[model samples]
Target chain A: GAGVSQSPRYKVAKRGQDVALRCDPISGHVSLFWYQQALGQGPEFLTYFQNEAQLDKSGLPSDRFFAERPEGSVSTLKIQRTQKEDSAVYLCASSSRDRGTNEQFFGPGTRLTVL
Target chain B: EDKVVQSPLSLVVHEGDTVTLNCSYEVTNFRSLLWYKQEKKAPTFLFMLTSSGIEKKSGRLSSILDKKELFSILNITATQTGDSAVYLCAAFKQGGSEKLVFGKGTKLTVNP
Candidate 1:
């Protein structure tokens, strides 16, 4: 079985520029989640989706961060204006059921750097 | 406020030795505690503990939760060099926007 996967393993963007990160969850997974991990730290929850519905977006740092999962399979996280503070690894995960119950399978995170 | 804390930020041990990692959490309305091993990218799940006094084991790795004390312990017996990585502990809240509260993690380095 293929695991969750993210694109553009590494990205570097100038400040004030916009960037988009992609994530492909496992097939048949009903739950998808995004997280941000800074260096020497653990991952912090960013958002969660159940199917095609955006269930939780509380962890999003600011209005610049937005995510969507229209078809219930692939998800994209967009930043309107990149900032140096946004430089971190963005991780995606998926589970067969609600994240409250099932274990999440992680993807190789996409490292984003804002210069 | 620190909701979860893992002690011994970094550890170094030789192969065939045993090691223990600790995690204590103060997550509101806690539901479960989970352990993950991270090397380079993705963090792989190791165990999920929802009940107290029940130990979960897989190969040389084992974990136990103490709900009453609000803590958990991950143990590795006869460790190998492959076991070297960052171990993360997370607390799942029963009902809240913050689903999983994670600790800073313990970086374990094993030498053969």
Candidate 2:
């Protein structure tokens, strides 16, 4: 695809169940980012990846939330134990440059609903 | 904590009307300010401003940043119904971990 793409546009999980979301950034993009957006609010930063290195995970809410970009092209976000509060749209973005003036291109987010 | 704030949580305008959206930030390591238009699942990039006072424009949409005042404004002139969406303002923080601190957003409704 010409732009970023995400799998499982919508996912529903029962409490305590685990779920994983996938993201495929634009080919050759050096930087990737993950965000969580709640209803009537803006996207909140969750983590950042510069190639295969997981540089920043400060914004991650809990230890249960984990993300990895093993090969630097595709990434996955895993939630170990789903909760109602974990319900939100997870967004993925990528920029060509690894640093400075990063104008990120976003993918259609995956909306997760925890029941 | 570093954060971005946007005003007028919601707005309604008719076709051919002009609207000005406001955003203010109090953040350290401010690399740049950005604007986005989100209608459904994804947010489309609109502008990214690093230097103060320079205007970035795309068709009817234009934006300007004032670093001194820690604020930015997005102006859309002669709006159309298709322009309706949630306009987001985000500040990209620099340094070891580059991340965007976003505001709650301003929802603009353009009715024809």
Candidate 3:
């Protein structure tokens, strides 16, 4: 695809169940970002990957949330023991360069609903 | 802690009208500010303002940043139905690590 892509556009999981969201950033992009957006709220930063390195994860809400980008191309966010509050749209973005002025391209995002 | 706040949580206007959305931020080591437009899915990039008093423009959309006031405003002229979306403002904090803090976003509705 020409732009960023996310898998499982919509996912419904029961409480306490685990879920994994996938993101395929723009090819050869050096910076990838994960953000969580709740209803009527702006997307909140979750983590950032510079190439294959997981440099920042301070925005992650809890230990149950984990993300990885082994090849520096694809990334995955895993939520363990999900609760109702964990339900939100997970968005992925990729930027061409690692600078303050780089504009990020975003994917369609995965809307997760915890029942 | 860094924070970004957007004013006029929601606005409704007829087509061809102009609207201005406001964003204010308080962050240590501010580097840049960005604006995005989100509809049903992900947000699309709009503009990035680093230097104060300079306006960035794309078609009918334009934005300007005020460093002294610690605020920015997104202006949409001749609004169309397609322009209806949530406009987001985010600030990048520069220091040991780089992080972007986003505001709540302002929802705009354009009626035909």
Candidate 4:
């Protein structure tokens, strides 16, 4: 079976440009999560979803970061007015159940760079 | 806020040696502690400990959690070069939609 996957493995955007990253969770996965990982640092949680409902978005740094899973499968993370500080690897993970219980399978991640 | 701290930011050991990595956390609504190994890519889950004083072992790797002391330890016996990677410790909180907070991680290098 296919594992979690993210599109645009590498993205280079102008400082003021906007970018959108996509995530495709494993089939039948009920839980999805997004995280941001800086170089030489651990992943920082950004948002989580259960099916089509957004359960948590507390870790989002600012209003420029927005995420949605409209149909309960694919998810999109949008960042408006990208800044240098926003350059990092955006990771997506999925689990069969809620994250608190099941092991999360991660994707290759999208490396976003603000030039 | 929940915080997970991993000690000895980096370690270097030779093959056939043993190494121990430590993790301590302060989290609200404590739930479970998890360990992960990362190479150049995504992290892969190792063990998840929700009970104290219980050892979870897999091959040459073993981990134990100490809930009373709010700490955990991962031990690797007979270290091999393949074990070289960044070890991340994460704490999961129950409330507020089950948050998982990760540590800065400890890098381990095994020389053959």
Best DockQ among the predictions, by candidate number: 2
The count of backbone overlaps in candidate 2 is 0
Off by over 4 Å in 1: B96-98
Q: On residues B1-112, what C-alpha lDDT tens digit does candidate 1 reach at each position? A: 5499998899999999999999999877888899999999999999999999999999999999999899999999999999999999998876544357789999999999
Model 3: residue B64 alpha-carbon error in angstroms: 0.6
CAPRI level of candidate 4: medium
Kindly provide the TM-score of model 3 when superposed on the true structure, using C-alpha atoms. 0.97
Ranking by lDDT: 2, 3, 4, 1
CAPRI-style class, candidate 1 = medium
Name the runs in model 3 displaced over 4 angstroms. A99-101
Give the per-residue lDDT digits (tens) of candidate 3, residues A1-115: 7999999999999999999999999998988999999999999999999888998999899999999999999999999999999999999999887655357789999999999
What Cα-based lDDT does every candidate model obtain?
Answer: 0.92, 0.95, 0.93, 0.92
Give stretches of model 4 more than 4 Å off.
none
Give per-residue lDDT, candidate 2, residue A1.
70
Name the better of 2 and 4 by lDDT.
2
Calculate DockQ per candidate and list them.
0.65, 0.81, 0.67, 0.64
By TM-score, the better pick of 1 and 3 is 3
Chain B TM-score, candidates in order:
0.96, 0.98, 0.97, 0.97
**By lDDT, is 1 or 3 better?**
3
Model 2 alpha-carbon drift over 4 Å, by segment: none
User: In candidate 4, what are the lDDT values of residues B1-112, reduced to their tens digit?
Assistant: 6789998899999999999999999998889999999987788899999999999999999999999999999999999999999999999887667557899999999999
